[model samples]
Each structure stands twice: as structure tokens, then as C-alpha cells.
Target: MVSDRRYCRWPRSSRERTCISSIGPLLQPSSDALEKQFDSWQLRITPVDYLLGVADLTGELMRMCINSVGNGDIDTPFEVSQFLRQVYDGFSFIGNTGPYEVSKKLYTLKQSLAKVENACYALKVRGSEIPKHMLADVFSVKTEMIDQEDGIS
Candidate 1:
């Protein structure tokens, strides 16, 4: 009479054990079932979109600065200064521009902004306000022009 058993009685040979161990897990059903699952993920805004947004904001601020200068609204000068600073800080985090270039541009802008602020303060302290028409005279030149005029060579 033969005994009926599911497992082998003797120790398995190394080759047999290796094959059995490798094949055993595949025979079981996994709880995760990752192979059968599906999902989708995507970004709402691409990096290009972010860069364009920054550029647009920068352009708008520049336009505002020009308008403020032309209008002689001293407060606008300060606002423009703050706006440029904010843009610089944001760009620093994004790293879209090289550090040296960005820093140079930022410093130049800041210096001009500070000059505008000081001029406005002086005018105010002298018991006079900047005329709107003089805004052009205040922020008329480009940052590069100011740098060149200042002999920043």
C-alpha cells in the first residue's frame, strides 16, 4: 500500500529547492494586484507656462513703472520698486536665469528704484509733490542708460 502525501518526505536537492521557491510565489494571488490597476497623473501647468507668466508679470510691472514716472505719482515709484524686488525673488527660486545675470539685473533695478524713491522723498520733504508730467523725466531712461550714465564701466 502506498502512503498519499502532498509534500516530499526527503530534503529537496538544491536545484529542486531553487526551482520550487521561485515558482511557489507566482502560484499565489497577491492582495495588491498592481498589474491590474491603472491611474493617470498630469501637471495643470507646465514649466513653460510658469516661465511665460513670470515674463508677462515682469513686462506689466515695467509698463507700470513707465506710466508712474510719466504721471508723476511718487507712490508708484515705490510700488514699482517693490514689484521688481518681488519678481527678482520669485525668479531666484525658479532659477530660470543664471545667478550672476539675475543678480546684476536685480541690483541695477534696485539702485534705480532707490534713486527714484530718494528723489520723491526729497521733493516731498521740500514741501512739493512730483508733477504727473514729470514722471517721464523721473523714470525716462532705461536701466542700462542709467548704469552707463553713472559710469558703471
Candidate 2:
């Protein structure tokens, strides 16, 4: 684990988690892959770190799903929908057992999962009716809902 990575004030403790966080897209939101990442990186990932990393992955998944929808790729969003559902389920089990920070991240993760689901729904339901050129515009505007909820610009 690189000692340079920072997360709030838990600097030293977040090293492994920081490494895990960077591998989100590479793992494609798979918990198994996350474990593999810890092994590959020669670091031990705690359940809290793993869950936090997965929570971070959901944000990436949302971006990918929204981009896929704009690009008119139906399959990607569909697969993302399933992946997010699994992540959500796994996270639900954590419930209130996780630390305060994990709870905060989980809240954001839920919002991201919801946005991804909505994007998938649009792709499977209303996507065909919308013109291709207008797809990007629609998704760009709609994805702001996520940005708004997350307080991202």
C-alpha cells in the first residue's frame, strides 16, 4: 500500500483502502475481484475497507451507465443494472454494523445505485423512442440529479 494516499484524517490507516479505491473500475464492481486485488497488491483488506471500496465503485458504475446510455449501448447499462443490484444487496447486509464513515459512503452509494437503475430503465424502456442525437443531451441533463444529490458540480 502506498503511504501517500489520503482519506480524511485516517491517513496511515487508509493506505490499503486507498489502493483498493483506485482499483474500482478495474474490478468492475465485483467483490471477488476486490479480494483478488488485495492479494495482488500484497495488502490485507478489512471488511470495512472492502465495503468502502465497493461503495466508491458504485459512483464509477453510475458514470459508466450514464455514458453507455448516451452512447446507445443497451447491453452495458443492463449489465451495470445487475451489478449495482448485487452491490446494493451486499451493502444492505452491512446495515448499521459498519463504521460511521462507511455509513456515510453507503448513503452515497445508494444514491448512485438509484441513478444507475434509472439510467438502465431509460435504456430499456424509453431509449428507443428518443432520437440518437438527443440521447446525450437527455442523459447529461438527467445525470445532474446524481451530481446534485452528491453535491458534485
User: Which candidate tops TM-score?
Assistant: 2
Q: For all the candidates, what are their Cα RMSDs to the real structure?
A: 26.6, 10.5
Count backbone overlaps in model 1. Answer: 5
**lDDT: which candidate is best?**
2
Candidate 1's C-alpha lDDT? 0.47
Error of 2 at 67 (Å): 1.2
Taking all chains together, each candidate's TM-score versus the true structure is 0.42, 0.66
Q: Please, what are the lDDT tens digits per residue for candidate 1 over residues 8-47?
A: 2222232332211222322444345563364322224445
Error (Å) of candidate 1 at residue 128 is: 4.8
Lowest lDDT 10-mer window, candidate 1? 1-10
List model 2 lDDT by residue over 37-138, tens digit each: 775433355667766766776777677777766776667666767767887888777777879878787788788777777777766688789886687777
